[model samples]
Target chain A: AQSVTQPDIHITVSEGASLELRCNYSYGATPYLFWYVQSPGQGLQLLLKYFSGDTLVQGIKGFEAEFKRSQSSFNLRKPSVHWSDAAEYFCASKGNTDKLIFGTGTRLQVFP
Target chain B: EPEVTQTPSHQVTQMGQEVILRCVPISNHLYFYWYRQILGQKVEFLVSFYNNEISEKSEIFDDQFSVERPDGSNFTLKIRSTKLEDSAMYFCASSANSGSYNEQFFGPGTRLTVL
Candidate 1:
């Protein structure tokens, strides 16, 4: 079974500071990785995805993630954090069966 | 851009009652999925539908739960004899196809509260 692990349960960053959320996955083959964000009372929004080719994938809201196959990691990063970026972020990986398994998620808190 | 939409933004039902959550997937999407997030937990896939049949389902999707695309655009999940454990945010997602490159678009989600 494919699974995702987000080591950080919560992350805090100051406005304009850099942010990085860790994600790791366990799958037999090359996995389809994705990052999603959910604001309070809103639906989950896709940040970005990685299927093949380039190791670094860019996403909406100035967020990006790098798929490190050797590390089994797809960590999300933002150069500068904004207050609006505070939300729950989830990392997911699609298995060969095409089912997306999600990580426990990291709740980001941005302070001024 | 087209997006998925779910109905009954919030539904509160009594235990043992049946509840149906509806969704209108993207007009051109061919694959539909249902997922749920229990409070403070990760979202778990329940079932995936394509060609009007279930293609994949997780153990979380048991006999008490069923999915149907009764019409052209509507995809619905029905839970029979709901339990308090069923309380969670139920989300509907759709993808253009099963291709690995395609991404699934998620709906706002329906908050189901079983009392």
Candidate 2:
């Protein structure tokens, strides 16, 4: 079975500070990884995705993720996070069975 | 830019009642999907539809749930008996192609509250 794990349940970061959210997955083959953000009461917004080739993939809203196959990790990072960046972050991996398994999610709290 | 859209931003229903959630996927998309997120839990996949038929469905998708593309633009999910556990944000997504790497555009979601 394929599963995604986001270690951080909640994270607080100051505005303009760098941010890194950890994600790990268990899969048998090379997995398709994705990062999504959801504001309170809003639907998910895709951040980035990794299918093949490049380990580092850039996404919308100044977000990026690096896929590490050896570690089974796909971590999301942002050089500088604005206060508006506060939201719930989820890491997901495509399952062969026809669904994307999502992580429990990490609530990002950005402080001034 | 094209995006998926869902009807009924929120629906309050009684237990055992039937509820239908509607979604209008991106016009040019060929695949549609349904997923839900229970409060404080991970988002879970329910089913996927393509070519006017179900391509795949998850274990969470049981006999109680069914999906239909009644028209060219509308994709609907019907729950036969609403349970308290069914209360969650239901999201509709669509992709131009069927692949793990294809981008799936999501809608605002409809919050289903079963009382």
Candidate 3:
């Protein structure tokens, strides 16, 4: 079965600091990876995705993700995090199916 | 900008009652999907619809659950008998295509609370 994993359950970072949320996936073939963020009481919003060719993909709200085939990882990164960036981040993948398999999610807390 | 929209932002229901969640996918999109997330669990896919029929469904979507696109703009998911375990945030998503690379835009979601 294909699965996506986010090792960190919760992470705290100071405002204006750099942020990196880790993600790993298991699939038989090259998977289409994605990162989504959900604020409290809000729906999941797509941050970025990785399909082919480009290992580093840019997304809305100054977010970026790098897809590493060797490690089966697609990690999300953002420079100079703002207080509004505090949200739950989820990593997802699609493999052989249209259904997206999502990670458990990592709650990010931005401190001033 | 076009985006998926779901009705009844929040719903409260009793066990064994029937509940229907409605959604209006993007006008030009051809694929629709339903997913749910428990309070502290990962989001799980429920089912996908294309060409007015169910293309795929997950194990969690049992006999009690059914999906229908009754009209050109409305897609609905109905639970024959709601269960307490069904309490979760249900999201509706639509994509222009069915390929793996196509991005699926999600709706605000309907939070269902079954008591």
Candidate 4:
């Protein structure tokens, strides 16, 4: 079955530190991958998405993700973390239909 | 900027009662979707709608669950009989089109609590 995996459940980073969250996906065809962030009491916000072409995609809030086909991974990265960036991050892939299959999210906690 | 909007930020209902969650998707979008996140769980897709009909649905969308675009502006999800397990944050989303490149804009979800 097609699925997205987020190996990390929780991650902590001091403010201004570099951050990376891992994601892997299993799909039969070239997949459409996405990264979304959900803050407490807020909706899921799209950070970035990779459909085709360039391996690295830039998204809002200084977030970026690289799609590595060989590794079947699309991991999110940020050069410097902010207190506001602390939220639950989810990795997802569009299924054959319009639905998105999401991984168990990784919660990021930022310390000042 | 245009954004999806949902009514009633939170709803509390007794088990076995019916509840309707309403949403207004981006005005020009053709596709609408409903997803839910149980507390401490991944967001799960429940159903997708387009052109006044359901285009796709997940296993979790059982007979009791139904979606409707009642008019031009409102999309609603109705649970015939709510269960305790139905407690979740229900989200409504829409994209300009169904294309792979179209980003789905999400709305602040409606939190449904069943007792």
Candidate 5:
């Protein structure tokens, strides 16, 4: 079975500061990776996805992630975060069966 | 923009009662999925549907749970008998196809509270 791990349970960042969320996956073959952000009382919004080709993929809200095959990691990064960026972020991996295995989310608190 | 939608933002029901959660995927989407997230836990896949049939299902999807696309637009998940453990946020997602090009579009989840 494919699984995903998010090491950080909670992270706090001041507005305008940089942010990095770590994600790792365990899968036999190359997996499709994704990042999603969910706000209070809102649906999970896709941040980005990595299927093939480029190792670095860009997403909305100035977010980006680097797919490091050797590390089995797909960490989301943003140089500057806004106050609205505060939300729960989830890392997911899609198996050959096409099911997305999500990790425990990381709750990001952005302080102004 | 086109997006998936779920109805009844919240539902409260007694244990042992049956409940059905409804969702409308984006028009033209071919692959549909149901997932649930227990409080403070990861979102787990329950089942996937395509071609008017189930394409895949996780172990969590047992006899107690069933999914049906009763119409061209509506996809529903039914719980035969609810348990306290069943109280969680249920999400519906749809993809244009099984191809990698089309990612899944998630709907605002329906929060089910079993009393």
Candidate 6:
């Protein structure tokens, strides 16, 4: 079985500051990782995905994540945060079954 | 950009009643799936449909839950008896039926509230 863990349940950051959201997964083989953002009462919006090849994958909304196989981590990072970035972030990973297992999620509150 | 589409953006049903959620996947896509996110929780997979049949489903997708592609373009999720716990955002997603790499396009989601 595969599972995902997002260490931070909630995070608050000031606008223009760098941000990092941690994500770790437990899977037997190489994991297919993804980051999704959900606004209040809305459906998920795909942020990015890392399947194979390049470890560092860039995504929309000025976000990116690096896949560290040995550490079993795919942490999301941004150089600077914007107030609009405040939302719930979820990290999901899939393998051979192609079934996505999502983490608990990290609530980001960006303040100006 | 081509994207998945879902109907009845919101549905309110009484407990123990049957509720069906509908979706229209991208025209070129071949694989479809249904996922739900309970309030303040992660999105959980319910089932995956492909080739006019079910390819996979999670434990949460028990006997009470079923999916069907009734026609050429519609995919639907039917819950035999709606429970209060079933009130959540139901999302329909689709991909090109190739592999796990191509990102899945998601619909706006149907917010089901069972009272």
Error of 2 at B79 (Å): 0.6
Chain A TM-score values, per prediction: 0.98, 0.97, 0.98, 0.98, 0.98, 0.98
The list of candidate 3 runs beyond 4 A from truth reads none
CAPRI quality level assigned to candidate 3 from its DockQ score: high
The most accurate candidate by DockQ is 3
lDDT of 2 at A92: 90
- Per-residue CA lDDT of model 2 for B1-115, tens digit only, reads 8889999999999999999999999999999999998988899999999998998888889999999999999999999999999999999999988676677889999999999
True contacts kept of each: 0.78, 0.76, 0.83, 0.76, 0.71, 0.66
**lDDT, candidates in the order shown:** 0.95, 0.93, 0.94, 0.95, 0.94, 0.91
Ranking by DockQ: 3, 1, 4, 5, 2, 6
Q: Report the C-alpha lDDT of model 1 over B35-105, residue by residue, as the tens digit.
A: 99999999999999999899999998999999999999899999999999999999999999896786899
lDDT of 3 by residue, A1-112 (tens): 8999999999999999999999999999999999999999898899988889989999989999999999999999999899999999999999877899999999999999
The better-scoring model by DockQ among 1 and 3 is 3
Root-mean-square deviation of every model: 0.7, 1.0, 0.7, 0.8, 0.9, 1.2
Q: Supply the DockQ value of model 1.
A: 0.82
Q: Candidate 3: how close is chain B to the reference, as a TM-score?
A: 0.97
Clashing pairs in 2: none
lDDT of 2 by residue, A12-64 (tens): 99999999999999999988899999998888999999989989999999999
Which residue window of length 10 is worst by lDDT in model 4 chain B? B96-105
Stronger candidate by lDDT (1 vs 2)? 1
- Identify the runs in model 2 with alpha carbons over 4 angstroms from their true place: none
Candidate 6 per-residue lDDT over residues A39-102, each given as its tens digit: 8766678999998899999999999999998899999999999999999999998888767889
Worst 10-residue stretch by lDDT in candidate 6 chain B?
Answer: B96-105
Encode model 5's per-residue lDDT on B5-69: one tens digit a residue.
99889989999999999999999889999999998888999999998899999899999999999
Candidate 1: Cα lDDT at A31: 94
lDDT, residue A100, candidate 6: 84
